[model samples]
Target chain A: MLSINDIHVQVDDKPILNGITLTVNPGEVHAIMGPNGSGKSTLSNVLAGRPGYQVTAGSIRYQGQDLLTMKPEERARAGLFLAFQYPVEIPGVSNIYLLKAALNALRKSRGQTEVDAMDFLALVKSKIKTVNLDESFLYRGINEGFSGGEKKRNEILQMAILEPLLCILDETDSGLDIDALKQVADGVNALRTPERSFILVTHYQRLLDYVQPDQVHVLAGGRIVRTGGPELALELEAKGYGWIEHLPRETGP
Target chain B: MNHSLTLDTRLHDRIPHLPGHRLDWMNQFRQERLAAFTTTDPGGKQDKQWHLSAAAAADATDPPHLDPAWLERYRLPDVFSLVWVDGVFCPHYCVREGLPAGVCLKSLDELSDAELTELRPDLTQPGLQEADALMNWNLAWLQSGAFLRIPERVHLEKPVQLLCITTAPVGLVSLRHVIRLGRNSRATLIHTQTGQAGASGTTGETTAIWLEQAAVLAHYSLQTQPATARHFARLDVATDTGACFHQHHLALGAARALTDIQIRAADQVSCELNGLFYADGNRQTAIYTRVQQAGSQGITRETYRGIATDKAHGVFEGLLQLQPGVRKITATLQNRNLLLSPQAQIDSRPQLEINAEDVQCSHGVTVGQLDEDAVFFLVSRGLSEAEARTLLSFAFANEIIGKIPLTACRDQARQAFLAALPQADIHQDWL
Candidate 1:
């Protein structure tokens, strides 16, 4: 479903990801593990077509199309979602309003009619339940004055509502307590389908404990140092990334 | 009759024909104000704080017939309303049904000589009198307006709406409004000024409000004129001890518009000022507010938001003055602005002059473009860049628009504000 070949990314003339290569089949959940400033978030952002992240070298293909050639909104309409590590608080824009606008935009891009108001509200109400948020939250400004855990849950709520094809959770596990972590993991697991793919970029293994990944990749010095089965996460958690810090980088698939 | 003549000169020639001209005190008042306006420079120079030049008032002409549907668009249901067409009060369109007893509402021309004489002190109160040239000019040409008064201890349930519509093609519309609330009385007043598309002239409005002890007054002013029109409005408010005053002003239209609001608060009085101004497509909108805490233990809060797009210009100047010996006063002022285009410009100045001890005062002003991160966040949700920006800009202005206390008025202001935004065609459900 997605291919990253020798991707080298730079932000503001500073290289963040160097010669990275990876591939994911449909329905595969890949856990990208790294230390601080190790470029895990950069890869997620690059995949989502965020601006200011220059793909200096290499190519990315999503659904057999050039992902780099698409605008952020274009990528979004094509079913690429990125749950931000630190979601921004947009005052005066209600959560439900944004959700409706986003869903309608995606539907319009696919030449579908707009969602019925009653149906949309019902969908939102059901989806919000999975994230453990009150109905009042949908009326308030987007994440305005929300607690840290609530903000993260709101991201999941949006994800559940939009139902993207390729989801990238950028540090979504951070700042979330154990309860919130489980709720988010359940939300993600419920949305997983045989045709959907997920890239979970995280710094900790706790989230993995809740949502099992198909593969685990340890990244260091802007390159993937090792790739293995889900057991790699347990190993990394035990040894704490230090044992693999000096490993040689993988060439490619 | 020369349209090119200076405003003062025109007023000088027309003073004899203006209403109340035969009364000696009224004549003296108009002459003195005209002199004051003439001596004060029409400020557009570099040294002046004003950023826009006042448009010359077009010669008065017979107002055009307005469609009922058009009039209904600006009317609020179940309220005592007065309609003004091209600076002239149209009694036929006035709605005064169910007006409570002990309430007085009348057109300035309808006021008897005795009423005018009794209100002379309030008309010329030194605190309400500023050296502003446009305000002086408004006083000099004041012929049409509404005067509303609520008697002591009487809480008026129905709001009073003063609707002014301009339909004279390139004609001047000048109005003056006076509101006085007696002790412990409460009232809501909505003042809306709008001009038809074909009407492109200058409008001058001045409102002087008096709130007696423990009275509560909620005043809203919504100005949405045509793109080619010029609007200048001034609000002078004075409150007695323990009174509460809430003022919401929305400047959403006009090619060049400036609103000046001045307030003086008495002991333990509370005052709140909320304002939003949007300028687009070479239009210029400005709001200047000065609030003075004249008595001890008063409270004042001011919040203003401005949006300028596509070579438009917006200006906000707020001044808070805490008089000496006014202890335990709390005053805060916040002004936030957004520039939607590279060529758009916004000027925000918040000044505080405190001469009292034991007072808490803070002021903050922010001028910035839409938050790029927030824009990306929205765009990443499948909305196009234009839609994202429009939504964000609407959100920015909604911070102030959401504070309008009256639902009907707020809805009207919100719709007007949304329509003024660039790419306002975004689905209404998203707002």
Candidate 2:
């Protein structure tokens, strides 16, 4: 479903992700594990087309189309979603308002009719229930004054509502309690299907315990040094990223 | 010394003499104020209050183009509306019927000698003596305005809407409003001023409000003059013990606009002043507010936000003064500004003077651009960059617009606000 070939990315003349390559097929959940400053976020941001990041050399293909050519909103409309590590708090812009705008924009891109208010509310209610958030959250400013756990859950709720084909979780497990972690995982599990894929960029193995991945890749030195099955995550959890960091360069694929 | 008080030769010649029967006290007050006004330079740099408004002293000598249709655009239902057109009272647009008992709403011209004398004390309270030249100018040339009196224990649920429309392209429109609320009275007053697009004129208004014990008053002022118009407005308020006063000022359009709000609170009184201003396309807007806590145990809160874009310049100056020996007073002031374009500029000054030791006062000011990460977040959610910017700007201004006491006014103002944005595709329906 996605092909990132030798994507060399940098920000502000400083290299972040150097010669990184990965591929994921349909219906497969891929977990990219790495130590601190290992370019995990750079890869996610590069895929999402965030500004200020320069792709020095590489090509990213999503469903056979060049992803790097699209703007951020176009990427979102094209079904590429990135769950930010830090969701912005937009005051006076209600969460529900943003969701409706996003949903309609996506629908417009797909040549579908805009959803009515009643139907949109119903859809939001169902999705929010899956994320275990109160209906009152829809009336509030987008994530304003929300707790850490509530923010993560809100991200999950958005993921459910948008239902993008390719979901990239950039450290979604960070700052979440165990209960919230499980709730987020369960929310993602419910959305798993043959046509939808996920790239879970995480630093810990605890998140993988709930939402098991088909493949686990160890990212060290800005490259995929090791690629293995779900057992690799358990092994990393036991040995820690310290062991991965000291491994020999140009190891495996 | 032939020290007769004088105005700028150009401005004095353009402004007509005060109309109606002027009482001895009113005449004396005007002369004293005008004398004081002549001594100080208009928009003096020596005074911190007038430094930002120095360039707003333009001449208004053109004829008035009175059109009734301007008032029709912003009319609300169930409102006792009064349309002031180009320094004149348009009887065809005034609606005072169906007023509740003990509620009297009329123009100064409609009141008799006896009625005017009865309201003399409230009108001549020495609220703003000589601190501002425009205040004096308003008193000297007071030609048309509204006067309202609410008796004791009376409550008027419906709002009184005052629409001031100016079609004059180089004329002066002076408006004076007096509102006297008896003990335990309650009312809401909305004042909106708009001019024609090509109109080159000046609008100076002075609003005096008296709130008795336990009285509550909500005052809303909206200034939307055109690019060729200059607007100078002042609101003077005095609240008695246990009274509560709420004021919201929104300045959306003008060539150069200055709004000064001065408030004095009595014992245990509460005052809330909020303002939002946006200036673009060479427009300039200045909001100056001063609050004096005279009586003990009073509370005052002020919040003002401004947005400047496309070479527009905006300024906000807030002063909170706690009188000496006034115990248990609490005051807070906040000013937040956003510069959307590189050429846009903003100057925010929030000051506090405290004489009483046992008081809690705080002030904060912030000037910044829209958060880039926040913009990206919204963009990642499928909104275009322009769409994201519009939403953020709308949200910034909505914080103050949401505080409108009436839903009808809120909705109307929200629509007007959205229309004022530079984006052509942005509208209320889309949001």
Candidate 3:
């Protein structure tokens, strides 16, 4: 239920994403594989409404609403989530406090009452188990002094709790070990529903082995160079992104 | 403007009636301090040591007597409380009728000759003879004060609050507080000094703390003076062998506020100092801390956070000194400040004097606005701009507030601190 048409994005007068178009229907998991500096993270930031990204052209529609015009908080209220590649460490705000505030804000936007402490605790406890994080994380500051793996797992734990409609995972597997990557992939897999969608952006195809995507798109030089079934990821993994640059320009399905 | 003449004139008039006038040694001490005040400059501008604070602007005229209804605002139940109104101890407002045994809360005038002699050494400690103008001024014109003595091995579960409320009109109110912790005693002291909003007055406060061996004392200084009021506060602490001292100071705002704190630790002593200061409008706040670890194995840790908005200014000067003979000493001093507006200013100076090469000493200072990435992250998580700022501000001050031993006091501290935030309409709910 998301549509993007020829979006041209730039940062500091330098073109990053040049004329990109993509659409995802309900319940579909789309994987965007690209090399470094291919604008994978830029796309996630633009969609999440982060400041400093200049969108010179094109429109993005989420459920027929203009997503580009909404503020970052408004976008979050509308069920768009982006898991950061480098999660910020806020020394004073606890992870649990953030999660509760986020959940309540979302609920308030949707005309729902705020969650009480007991129910919120129960919900957080159950969701934390999915990422193998203990309850102590609830009291500690958000990602403050957390290990690399624990931070990734905490991001996944947040995803599980927020239960957003469209989840954008930006290199969530970069710092994770194989076992941690499997756990994160499993956590993402379990959250998949007929009404939910995901856009997994990664440079490596290793994560694809844990949670196979419904569609794999190869992004090279800031544009979608190739689009195919899940086998495309395997092909790229076996042959690397160098061969995709030699292919013809019009390779998208 | 120089205040030496006006201060000297006032000291001459009030020397006869100052507290402890009946005691010969106390009078001699007062006279010596008065003589020092006439010679030394309070601002230290010649040495460039008071660059941030520049000058002491407190008025030296005698304040118009005022007896306002301020006790109701600061009174908390079940704790021994004392009230000082406009630098005068208010016996009618004090609540110490049935204090527990081994606990003594008395006005300086009420101390017996024996008690005075026993506490004279601590009261007349060399640190009390500091050459600082503010210290000398406080000693010379000190009009009212309290003497708190926690007997040996006495443990106080409840806090003892000293509320100093200023309602003086266009003049200075000078006072002193003496806290003596006997050997192995444990106590908590909360000192709150507040003035009428926008009142044009000055408050000079000095506190002396003496901790014997194995004694522990938690001291909190909460200052919420008006934007038009000028306040000068000095705290001197001395800890014997194995004693521990925890000091927390929170300043909201004033026309100009200056704080000088110095602590000396004996062998195996530990000191933790935390401070949070907020300045809004055109107000200014400055805190200078000097910690001397004279004994081996002594530990000193200090952290200070400041928030300045509008054209306000904030300053922090921290110095950690390890004596030449001291070894195995560990000290850390950190100052972090946030400027909410471009015009706001903050100056931080963290210094270390490690005479012993084997000791470990570290200092860090940072000055910046809100983290853009952190604010954006919080906003993307559905918090409004105001909410995100409030959350960050709360977190910045949470470390200091968390050290409050009493939950009720902690909550009050949090509320008062949040209410003073200039960034947003910060509420206590976020905290």
CAPRI-style grade of the A/B interface in model 1: high
List clash counts for every candidate, in order: 0, 2, 0
Q: Which stretches of candidate 1 lie over 4 Å from their true place?
A: B1-17, B44-55
Tens-digit lDDT track for model 1 on B1-431? Answer: 54335655666677675667668988788878767765676663111323123335545756557887899999988789999888888888998877888899988878777888787876665344454777766777786798999999999898899999988767777788888999999999999999889777778888889999999998989999989888888888889999999989999998888888889899999999999999999998989988989998888999999989899999999999988888999999999999888999999989999998999999999999988999899989999989998888988988788888788898888899887876785566556
Strongest candidate by DockQ: 1
Q: What local lDDT does model 3 show for residue A49?
A: 94
Per-candidate TM-score against the hidden true structure: 0.96, 0.93, 0.91
Candidate 2 versus the native: TM-score?
0.93
lDDT rank order: 1, 2, 3
On a 0 to 1 DockQ scale, where is model 3? 0.59
Q: iRMS of each prediction in angstroms?
A: 1.0, 1.5, 1.6
Q: Estimate every model's Cα lDDT from 0 to 1.
A: 0.87, 0.83, 0.82
For model 2, residues A14-94, the per-residue Cα lDDT tens digits are 988888888888899999999989999989999998999999998989988899998999999998899999988987778
Fnat of all models, as shown: 0.85, 0.72, 0.64
How much lDDT does candidate 3 score?
0.82
Model 2: DockQ against the native? Answer: 0.69
TM-score of candidate 2 chain A against the true chain A: 0.97
Best by the TM-score measure: 1
Candidate 3 lDDT tens digits, B1-431: 45556556655666666656667887777777767766775454122233112224343345334444456666655678888766767777788866779788987656675776677775655473354766666677667677998999999877888988776556667777888899999998888888766566668788888899999998888888878777888888888999999888898857788888989989989899989999989988999999998898888999999989889988899988887888889899999999888999999999998888778889999999889899888888888878888788777877677777777677777777876775554435644
Inter-residue clash pairs, candidate 3? none
